[model samples]
Target: MNTWRARLLPPALAIVFAAVLCSVVLLVSGANPLATLAEMIAQVARGTTAVDIVNTAGAYYLVAIAAAIGFQMNLLNIGIEGQYKLAACVASIVGGAISLPFGLHAVVIVVVGAVVGAAWSGIAALLKVYRGVSEVISTIMLNMLAIGVVAYLVPTFGELRGNTQGTKIIPDSGQVPGIPFGGAGTMFGLVLLAAAVGVGYAVLIDRTRYGFELRASGLSSTAATAGGVNSKRMVMSAMLISGAVAGLAGLPEILGRDHTFTLNFPTGYGFAGLAIALLGRNHPIGVAFGALLWSFLDKSSLTLDNIGVPKEIVTILQGAIVLSVVVAYELVRRRELAAEQRRVGRALGTAAAPAAAGTGGERA
Candidate 1:
């Protein structure tokens, strides 16, 4: 099999399997699966829907990349949720409190976000390295701590106008500009930032020495150490990079749309990012497609109630896709590994047979 085909086939088959399973589910629930699919297709065709999909995908792409960084190093930085929320809160407060020129203001806000996220994530990295703490536990605890911190600080320092509770509004100079996509449709300007991040991620992971070390460490820490790779440093770097990218997860909404961290500021992108990263197999391009597909399904679900189809059907489909794809990928990987071992064994046996025959003839 061609390498590319081998890589893609499992995911394609997984998607088909998931679709069929979802259709059966809908049929059992007495809904027209075909009609529901058609509605989803139609929703994607609308210009306004395109904007929403792109905007959501932009944020999701960042989160997925953040998760992918940790994944590449065999580290699970579940603290992305807390890292991003805390970053957004601090960034918003800083952006609103000070004034700077247009370009500088946006730069400062982004820097603040990345710094805050890295700082928060560093705690987990330190604990893992020094205290032998599991990142999963520490990050989860950090998330709760972040939520409590945000809850207290927002009401204390955040501005309040009637019922709307949020940080101070960012000035126009500090806000990111949007690109108009036909009338009544505007794509977030930070979509370009997300694309840039993707490109950088691809280059760093596929083209850099550091990336090679990171991947080596992920495959086996002991092996990597034997090859002169510092597994501890790699873990720390991966955690920090993951957190920094995670910080940007909320900036698309904050700078390009809402312009403030508020009670209504979106959550759950961190968890969604983890799923997208898994679905994409941690590849940059794959993650981009995963993010877009996930966002499209989420946005399309809004109209399901109008069509008398349950919105939860989309959730079922999404979950099924993730589960099926993961299982399929694992099975395919094992099959590939077995085949490679067989091929190597045959080659060795052939070589040994020729050498043994020569030696036997000499003895004769």
Candidate 2:
């Protein structure tokens, strides 16, 4: 049941249910659901400018991977949206501040961006370690702070200034070029995200002894402490890693997609990332694929409706997909726990039976 394939099946089935429900919605709305779906298919075939979708989806992927890493440690980073906002602002300001060579400027900007995002999240980590605040609540509150502070900084000081908006478009030197043919830089964004995920898997799950300790601590923090693992350090490290990934999402906007920080750019990327993490079973590769599927549906929505499908139909289906995954994960988790308990009980019972029989034989 812990296998990726095993966990994936339930979500896949749920998606099928969602698709059927969407069809039902189309029928009830007096639309030719099949035709509507076909038109949507055609639009996807025609309108998908690879670079744009890939870039936007890359943002979603980075955030999803970040949350998924936290999830692996049994930590929930619900504040990635805030983390990204602050990080993007920091990156833009840093990029604009320096007049360095192109390579150094981009590197410095990205590093500062990642640092700021990590530092912002470190606040929540500090609270969890010292004040015993739940990361969920603390991060959520921190998100509010991030949104306000960045929102202020972008308009007031970031490059998008003068017109009461965010920073001006990032300089051409700071911007990463698109794939040779152009359109949007989404594919390039996706490539960077892939690299990030690979590095993340290596750093978080394999390369370091910390990965082993973190896994042990995540499964049972108290037991891991008894075993001499520094669970506190692992917690902070996990949070910092989550923040760094969130910051990388800014690359899509700052250097790839938008080329500048905006006051209220759509934050659906971060929100969708959370869902993708859950649907992906918190694994890096799984989350990437989950992000891809999520991005596809997102890109397809408007086109689908124009094909006669009602908005309510896709909306309900999408919502159901999340709900179904949540429910199924819970169910699967419960079953696994129950099975483990039963196995333990049987082992204990067998050991006790042997002891009792030996004692009785000796007494007789």
Candidate 3:
């Protein structure tokens, strides 16, 4: 019961806190908060909207996992957005340029994406490891550099399709089909890929020695080093792993839907993923919930304009939720620590009681 409470209470409180705050905002804006919320909830009853939510959540899940990986090693990989875009561009070009067996073609695209993402991230990792440069700064700069690189490479390797210039369209053999979801739109088959990545992330964090070192390094680099863990190696490995996964963030859209990378490709997922990662406290299951909630707000908010309420209210709500979750989690952590201390104190007192009684008896 205590464990369940510990796990559930913070997010529950956070959600309620955010809701209340948003409600106040709605009232101040002269909108019926209850009605606006009701309309948003009603939108989910539509099959198409539900499918969109799940599809969006799947992509958000992958992005959050990528952010969580670097976070686990205390490295802020702000370059996930750039890493994924560049990877998608290169992977799409290669995927379109190749001819292979069905499964092999898709595999090649995925591998190319991972490798390019890792290579891009490796630059920041090397700088941090050798030159004592902060990853935060390097990654921010790299993001701008990636934008320029992609702009230059796109036209060089790609042709203009209509008005949009992009890489060649991938062959059918390189694409994965979406799963039909009744009357609703087809769901991305690669949502399963999100599930697989989540499982792999959980396993890596909970079962592997490298995961242990990563966590230890994040907690305290000096302590991890003293325990015979190489801090530099862990940082590089974590960043590479993060970038590799970040590379895949765009694959679902490319392989399942777009079949190519374009200038108009979706953006903002990297930053949103960072927020979701924080809201989820870096846990796989937690991140899944965060992604779903975030997606729900994003998708449902579109209906708000119909009800005379601004859709950007959802943005304020999301910001509130993130802030509330962080504060709630910290408070819960302190409470848990105090409770633990009390339990230990009581146990030590109970054990000392018998020893004290025996000593007194002997003296008597």
Residue pairs whose backbone atoms clash in candidate 2: 51-186, 54-186, 55-186, 159-167, 159-168, 160-166, 160-167, 160-168
lDDT of each: 0.90, 0.76, 0.91
Model 3 off-target regions past 4 Å? 1-3
Separately for all candidates shown, the number of backbone clashes (residues 3 or more apart, or on different chains) is 0, 8, 0
Which candidate's lDDT is highest? 3
Give the per-residue lDDT of model 3 (tens digit) for 159-264. 8988989999999999988999789887887788889999999999999998898999999999999999999999899989988988988898899888988888
Which candidate do you rate higher for lDDT, 1 or 3? Answer: 3
TM-score of each: 0.96, 0.86, 0.95
Better of 1 and 2 by TM-score: 1
- Scored by TM-score, the top model is 1
Identify the superior model by TM-score, candidate 1 or candidate 3.
1
Considering only N, C-alpha and C atoms within 3 Å, which residue pairs clash in candidate 1? none
Q: What is candidate 2's TM-score against the reference?
A: 0.86
lDDT of 3: 0.91
- State the weakest 10-residue window (summed lDDT) of model 3: 1-10
Cα RMSD for candidates in order: 1.4, 3.6, 1.6
